[model samples]
Target: MSVSQQVIKDKLQASIGDIYHIIITDTSNGCGQSFDVIVVSDTFEGKNKLQRCRLVNGALKEEVAQIHAFGCKCFTTAEWSKLVV
Candidate 1:
């Protein structure tokens, strides 16, 4: 994990409570060469995917600027569990 990852994870942890899991994949160049983040948290509550992703973006504003592309899969714990069901 990079500094940005830790900073992001810490900020997210504060707002979301216990994180079920977090996965960050560092990809290649161009727009596709971006970080793909999957965050599972209870704090997502009534937020839609866009809202949850926006929140994460807000939390990592600086980091976002440093990268060319950004991608995220945000999920509430309940939503994530349902995916496995």
Candidate 2:
């Protein structure tokens, strides 16, 4: 019944749509209790950091309640492109 990284990634991709990139890491080192997620998508356009986090939190509400820790970094496609270039 524990939430896995793939589950989180799938849910996010489904909720947000058209993800440019996504990386979910199990920071708990195999415990499956904590995670770090980095997502880049156009769904974040015009949203600030807090707003973006809220959107992600809302999408993962149920899964987050089951996990001990969830860290998310969301970026718009433009923002992500800037970082990589």
lDDT of 1 by residue, 1-85 (tens): 2435566567667766668888776664323336778999876888888898888888777677777677889888788899879
Choose the strongest candidate by lDDT: 2
Question: What TM-score does structure 2 among the candidates reach?
Answer: 0.93
Report every candidate's CA lDDT: 0.74, 0.90
TM-score to native of every candidate shown:
0.75, 0.93
Model 2 ranges off by over 4 Å: none
In model 1, what are the clashing residue pairs, if there are any? 28-33
> How do the residues 1-85 of candidate 2 rate in per-residue lDDT, one tens digit apiece?
6799888988898898778999899999998999999999888898889999998898899999999999999998889989999
